[model samples]
Target: MILSIKNKTLAAITLLSVISVSVFADDNQLTAQEKADGWQLLFDGTDMSQWRSFKQPTVNEKWQIEDGAITLTAGGGGDLISKKTYKNFELTLDWKIAEAGNSGILILADEKGKYIYSHAPEIQILDNERHPDNKLDTHLSGSLYDLIASPIASHKKAGQWNSTKIRLENSALTVWQNDVQTAKVTIGSDEWNSLIAKSKFASWPDFAAAKEGHLGLQDHGDKVWFKNIKIKELN
Candidate 1:
């Protein structure tokens, strides 16, 4: 068949768009390049074997795989932690909260503490517009809970998925929510110490002190769904 230049250009653009979408369309699965780059999938939509209840040998029954997402159902499930520990890495995940629900992603979590929040600093997750935690900017979704407020409130509404990416390399922490830079801080620095002193973690001397620890997902007795949980270690 014969085609004009404009028609040929339009066909080429459409072909490229289709190829681009096909390359990155799947959830809970990594592209070839991602696998080559050392990305690990925590939950690949098949099982939660990579995780367990905090201080427990197995995951709670209530934390189930629902529609390929790790769902916290009802209460008493306890916090979920990664079986393997990491030091400095980049973690990314997608989460959705129930109406007025509250949850958090914990980094540097360890079993030595009575509670997960004791040793880990959290990236806040909540239905920002309705949750009571919204009363304080530091507690809003995407914040470094109680320490650094998310510079931009970029969370989607409740029942909708929100993408969060957290990077902690040499204790220089950075967070992004839905592709927008939300928070940044240097952990254990003078500024971080000062912020913690005025926050509720003031009494917890070991807050986020671990050199290496497991990742955690807070139960918070609320319904929250998480998926596409992945991580990549950094040198």
Candidate 2:
């Protein structure tokens, strides 16, 4: 049957609305452009199937999905690591920590030492304004945890979500927190070696030794939430 003019206009409007929603997809869903660039979601907010407890085959009970975020409710959950490992890549995520809480995003993490941090370089996650860790610049949010300090403070306050972007390509590493450039370094370079020589990692012989490994989220005995975790592997 032929449609009336008014019906045709309404149908066109509905089609436009659908297209708009598709263009501006919600969190945890990749847009078409991202998918084309090889971006993959690690946590789409529904489950933790993409991650497991560090060095283990499963996730722990304390890490739960709440309000579409992977939240660490209490102690004993251990660190969570991605099922797949990556080398050169770009990773983005949103996180929020409780008051005085602490956590971290571990890169090139492997089970070569007694603890995950012993082998992995970390981008720290902390409530900078309230945590005791705030006393040191290297311990603040977005820092290369004790090895390098974030040039500026850009993290949102506790309970507020902060966006983080990390890219490691061709031995060069860069990080952005909330759109502000936080850290930049070239792995295994003279500068990087000097930084590690003075930091706590100097005692850990295998720190940052892996060229490819799993992405990790630290437990840190505190409550923290993460979402919109996505990564794009590079050549």
Candidate 3:
């Protein structure tokens, strides 16, 4: 069912994201040939060359690279984001809690200090059974942060890596957990727009209106590890 909704949502936002992407292009960097070739690694498993902390009014003191993975350390704050702002792209990464009582998030469609969930929707990563942050509508691992909830239960043991795939085409968003689509969402729909209008993004410029933006990894600071990050730039 989740996969079905994801496909349908992609169909709905295909036109919107494409049109918006063209409008938002900083440069015509990716040619048709590039899209035809194959996938690209956003994170080569050994470097932090492609990501940085979220700008202004935020901090990520807990992020570190260990054993080829981005791991969370003590006192980490805020989120880490891609240096390359994207209009549309497919992203893959893996994450897991270090303990049975922790949580984190994988964010997309971001535009700076606006409400975290309102501007940058996140895929929740948590130990559902024991995490201190566990909650139904918005706190479960694999959720769309606060916008959409995961229909299935995912409680990968603490300290065990779990995978996630996220694809965002302008307003269209899809998420997969352990190779299964877990949540699908379309922004700018009447329903999505309504939610946007009532949230912090309503008064924030380019909050959720962006065509291209960064991919963010949130640090909720309870010990999480991330690796195998990659992406295939889309046209």
The most accurate candidate by TM-score is 1
Per-model TM against the reference:
0.92, 0.91, 0.71
The TM-score measured for candidate 3 stands at: 0.71
Q: What is the lDDT of residue 67 in candidate 2?
A: 93
lDDT of 2: 0.90
How far off is model 2, as Cα RMSD?
Answer: 3.2
Judging by lDDT against the true structure, name the best candidate: 1
Q: Please identify model 3 stretches exceeding 4 Å from their true place.
A: 1-36, 56-62, 100-103, 106-118, 153-155, 194-207
Q: lDDT tens digits, residues 145-207, model 1?
A: 998888655868899999999999999999999998988889888998999999999998788
Tens-place lDDT digits, model 3, residues 19-38: 76655422213334434566
The ten-residue window of minimal lDDT in model 1 covers 18-27
lDDT of 3 at 17: 84
Better of 2 and 3 by lDDT: 2
